[model samples]
Target chain A: MHQKIGERFDGRVLDGGAPDGMQTFLVEPDLIVEVCRFLKEDPELRFDFLADVCGVDHYPEENRFEVVYHLYSIPFIMRARLKCRAGDPPKVPTVTGVWRTANWHERETYDMYGIQFDGHPDLRRIYMWEEFEGFPMRKDFPLKGYKDAYNPFGEDIDAGGRDD
Target chain B: MTDVTILTENKKPGGGSKEVLLNLGPQHPSTHGVLRLVLEMKGEIVSRIDPFIGYLHRGTEKLAEDFTYTQIFPLTDRLDYVCPPSNNLGYAMAVEKLLGIEAPIRAQYIRVMMAELARISGHLLITGALPMDLGAMTVLLYTMREREMVMDLLEMISGVRMHTSFCRVGGVREDLPEGFTERVAEFCKVFPQRIADYERLIAKNRVFLKRTKDVGVISPELAIDMGLSGPNLRASGVDWDIRRDSPYEIYDRLDFNVIVRDGGDCYGRWDCRMEEMRESTRIIEQCMRDMPEGPFQVDLPQVAFPVDKELLQRSMETQIHHFELSAYGFKVPKGEVYVAIEAPKGELGYYIISDGSEKPFRMKVRAPSFVNLQALLGGATNMNYLADVIAMLGSLDPVLAEVDK
Candidate 1:
């Protein structure tokens, strides 16, 4: 499938091989929608299902954020992982045109890692409230999280403990 | 601030339909867990739905980053709280895949049995709850009684009813207790008749059929587009079950029919689940009959603790291995893998990235409920009555924990 895709889209999509037998492809952010459309539209490889979209925050790296798309070809029963570096502000073009289900998964990636889907229809925080503090899924974000009255560290310490 | 539509079909000279805003907040019982929907309604027919989720988000993905591979097992249980074994097995298989090892043959059969049993338990809830959502009360009572049998079986096997973190990275925590298979065989013997009783109660009932037969109809294209899985996808007549299509574990060895119905409505979803439960019983019986006799987990002391408890007390090397495994869990090799199991709800997956560390660098749960619930916005529920929304939700079977996670 990667060869079939690589032959058509020439150097636009590069194979990211792993020890595990998961078929992975690293796509350029700008040409992702094109590649995804090609992958879905091709008669032999109908990767219709967008299984999931998630963000990986690689702190201090040049390309800070990586957005991973898990796609499944239902007709052929093959799976592919398309990843693109959503560089500092973490913006990647939406594939909602290819598969409508990317809507909520994109919203969730935005909510968790602050990555932006370029053409998402109704992009909003699907999980956290609008007024929440920071992207919790980022590597720099503290695991203890912000302390509130309802979620006060769970300790009977001084009330003056600073919020991270 | 919201766009409103007029019901032109019932238009009178001046006004036949007035748009109303209904805030079915988190408190609505039929919302299942904490799902808030902003429904744009013209009288009773809903035009558009804007659902507000995340009330139950616990940052499991973020939390998993700080926990070890073994510690992450309990967290997966909470995603699909109905059938936790499937989550456990999915995670276990993912870690094993990364390590490039397989759990012993006996363990694979046992894990499959557990997953199928969890599927039955999960299907049992929707079988009862979907009807209870539509105003029938007795089905839930009868189904709960049967669910207790599953719970009892789980307790007998894993010592827990709900969150049976029985599965470990290499394999299961322990082997089945004596007489467990006999009780399971008895369940397989009696469950088919109980399914018949359920069909008598509601499958043929006129009111139940009327409420669900054509309501919330999902076309095969829309279901696949919106990423519906498990029984929901099968209910729409798309024959794409991961168990059959992509065999994980010993599923290829086991023989059972994948239930598919062309109804593509709430009734079809329910009917699919009922047929699936019967298939699950068949699966369990076959797994037990051909059950292999060998070590449950692989012989990797670093990955999993030894099965022999006496070795920890008696042998010095065993003690050190146990101590290291307990103090700090095993370090997985530097790689990433995504393992998805056909969970009762759908494809429950865990994508784990290991930076050659004790804890996962990044872990993302591909929850089925979250994607399946997105189909509600695909116009199936649009033009549906406000009450049909509940029926649709029940049919979709989106557990809010999995959705919001």
Candidate 2:
């Protein structure tokens, strides 16, 4: 299916390989929406289900954020993973116009990783509080959060505790 | 906003009224879990529903970054608390895919059995809860009684009722207990009669029909467009089930019918789940009849925990290997895979990315309830009465844990 897609898009595939029986392709971010549109519309490769859309932060990499889309073709009984990258304040075209499920998924990605989805209808924080600072999923973000930040319980509970 | 304008434009000139902002949940019992539905209501009719989720979010995906593949299984158990085994299986399959290994055939059969059992218990709870939400208290009591039996069976095998982290990456935590098959068979024998009892109460009841027959109708095209999977999509006449379509685990070998309906309404959804429970019983019976005797987990000592204490004491190599595997965890090849299974609610998928590290680089759970809850936005609640929204929500059966995962 990746080869077929590659031929149809004139080798738009930046990288292609089967890792652990999962067919994955790295494609240009600009062509992702178009490629997805084709994948859904094409009769031979009707990847109808937008299974998931998530962002991965590759810290220190030039293009740090990679947006991954998992597509499931019901008719063909096949699955494909589409990968694309963006830099700081990462932005990628939203596929919501192609699949409505992308709306929430893109919002979730934006909320967690701070990756902006271009043209998304409602691109607000889906999980975290709207006023929360920083993307918690990013590699650089501390797991316990910043020490000097506001503590809702009034004081740092750990301050009085004995050190192990 | 667009919907409001359209409603006003289409309304009778004298019938135009002020739209009321009604907050349905985040506290209401019918909303199921900590789900908040901000409904734009015109009198009793709901014009739009804006679902405010995440009150239950614990950032399980973010937490997975620090946990090893083996340690991550328990987290999956928390996603869909109703059917933890299904979540465990989906996560296990994704990690196993990355490691390029398969659980032994006996383990696969056992997985099918456990998943089917989970499906039954899950459906029973949903079936019971929906009717109870609609004022049928008897159904909940009856279903809870039956559910207790299923829970006991799960506890017998996994020693835990709700969040049974029974499934491991290579296989199950342990093999089936003695006479477990017979107990399941006994449950299967009496379960159909219980289904009949449920049908008697709600199948043709005028009140049940009145509330659910035509409410929350999701057209086939709209359902597919929204990416609805599992019984919800099947009820909408999509004829797609990951078990039958993709044939995961030993589902292909098992003989069972994928229950589908053409109504595309709340009743259709209810019927699909009810019939599916019967099909699940059938699958479990067949699995038991064709049960094979062999090792449950694969012999990957490096990947699986070294459970054999005797072997660890005797073999120095085994002891060191177990220590290394336990300390550093197993290294997976740098790649990503999305593996989904037909969970009780819908397609429970695990999207995992490994950077040739002991811990997962990124883990995303394609929670069924989270995705299916979008159906409400897909016009499932549009133009319906505020009262009907409860029935619609009950039919959708969104487990807040899975929804807000």
Number of the predicted model whose DockQ against the real structure is largest? 1
Q: Against the true structure, whose lDDT is highest?
A: 1
- lDDT at A108 for candidate 1? 91
Grade the docking of candidate 2.
medium
Q: Provide the TM-score for each candidate, comma-separated.
A: 0.95, 0.93
Question: Compared with the true structure, what per-residue lDDT tens digits does model 1 show for residues B1-405?
Answer: 113233444355646566656788687778888999988877677888888888999888988988988999999899889889998999999989988899999999999999999998988988999999899999999999999999999999999999999999888999999999789989999999999999998899898988898889888988888889988998998998899999999999999999999878998999999999999999999999999899998888888898888888889998898899998999999989988889999998889889999999999999999988887785563328878888899988888888877
Clashing pairs in 1: none
Model 1 TM-score?
A: 0.95
Predictions' DockQ, in order:
0.79, 0.69
Per-residue CA lDDT of candidate 2, range A16-72, in tens? 677656687887878989989998999988998889898888986887899999888
Q: What is candidate 1's lDDT per residue for A49-155, written digit by digit as tens?
A: 88988899887688789999998998999988988998766789999988999999899998888888998998888788897767778886667765667667633
List candidate 2 segments past 4 Å from native: A148-164, B1-16, B381-383
